[model samples]
Structures are given as structure tokens and as C-alpha cells.
Target: MSAAGGGSAGSIRIDRLLVYLRFARTRSAALALIDTHALRRNRKHVLRASEQVRIGDVLTIALGSGVRVVELLALPPRRGSPAEAASHYREVDSDGLDRKGQMTIGASSPAPGILSGDPEDFS
Candidate 1:
């Protein structure tokens, strides 16, 4: 789903997407992440930085300390502020772990108030 204010409507290069979403500080960093096989799109290894990713795609990124699984809610037109970039995707607890990476007893829910609206909308 595109953003309310006319966001990009087609697939985006994964490297660019990473920068736009603030996953990486720069495009080169994003490429390095991909080169190291630290990113997976829909559970499959991302072979290149140019791999296309669209709205609703789930990305599992292995960061320095932990993993981050996020679903693209919208493709931002540019790399905006932290809050704006945050609104473009939703963090997902794919492994049923909480903030500390410990297993949870019940369903995993997105962090409250990080973004407005139901995350299930992307599902």
C-alpha cells in the first residue's frame, strides 16, 4: 500500500529501500549488508543490493547485535526523518521473541504507538 501522500508506486531497489527506511546509514552500508548475506526478503537470501522490494514485503535483517524483521508498509518518496522512515514499515516479532529476544507466551504484537493503524492491514 502506498502512503497517503503519493508515495512511490512500484518496486524499489533493496539498497535504496534500506536507506530510505533508515535500516542503513548509507547506500554503501546497505550494499555491504546485502553482500554479507545479512538480509532476507520474504525469508529468501537477498543476492544483490538491486533486488526489488515492494510494499508488503517482509525483510529480515541481521544487525550488529540482533535481528530485525520488518514489513514494508509503504515506500517513502525520500529518506525523511526517523519518524517518517519509521512510518514506512512495521517491526515484526517473527520469532515470537519480545524486546529482549526471549520467547513469549502468547501472540506477538507490534510495539504500541510506533506507528498509527493496524499492522494487519499489510497482511
Candidate 2:
């Protein structure tokens, strides 16, 4: 129930975009990049982190070797978990999401300080 580069015209709140950007692992990093003027919406530089984004809006972000363009799809009211945020938009024909599936495979790990050694060894 989503389309990329094409969607029913609608307005999406700024908070939702923050969640989506976080989900994409691009918000925090994008925020830093944006500070350097590396992000654009519809060809216009986006300087504010709280700006609202609407459906069908094209977002161009600078990647390591190239730029990525994403078309906003649906908009939700509040930010959700990574899984929920992903449901809000469909990635356009861009390399930005090409490694998405690969990323989920090794996404999480045990806490850094957690140990599985013998309990008696602690004594």
C-alpha cells in the first residue's frame, strides 16, 4: 500500500520525518551532514532540522560516493520503532536502501559489557 516517487498529495508532520530519518540511520548522521549543507529537498537546501516534509517530496542526501534521492510516501503522526517507521515510506529506485535487508541481519548485538563466562568464575 505504498508508492515511491508518486503518492497521494498530503502533508506529513516534522516529528514523523525525524523518526523516518532515524530509522534510515540517516537523521543523526544527516543532521551532522546537514550542518555542512549536504542535504536538499526538491533541489533546495534544507537547513532546518524541524522542517515539515510532505508526500511526494524528493529528498537528496549526500552519500559517501554519490547522492541519494528518496521520495516521501506516507506520513504518520508519531515516531515508532524502526519496524514501524519503515512502513511509512517506500524507497525510490535509489541505492540508499540497497543494503537495507543486509543491515537487519547483523543489526543488534549483546550489550557491550555483558559476559557469558562461567558464573563461578566471577567469585
Give the winner by lDDT: 1
| Candidate 1 per-residue C-alpha lDDT over 16-123 given as tens digits, one digit per residue, 9 for 90 to 100 | 888777777677878777776767888778998778888889887776545678899987878887788889998887564234633222212222211212334212
Worst 10 residues of 1 by lDDT: 107-116
The residue pairs that clash in candidate 2, if any, are: none
Q: Put down candidate 2 lDDT per residue, 1-123, tens digits, no spaces.
A: 222211334554332364444422334544555555655666677777666578678666554434446676766645466556557666567454444332111112222221112233122
lDDT (CA) per prediction: 0.68, 0.49
TM-score, every prediction: 0.70, 0.50
In candidate 1, which residue ranges exceed 4 Å CA deviation? 1-9, 95-123
Output the number of the TM-score-best candidate.
1
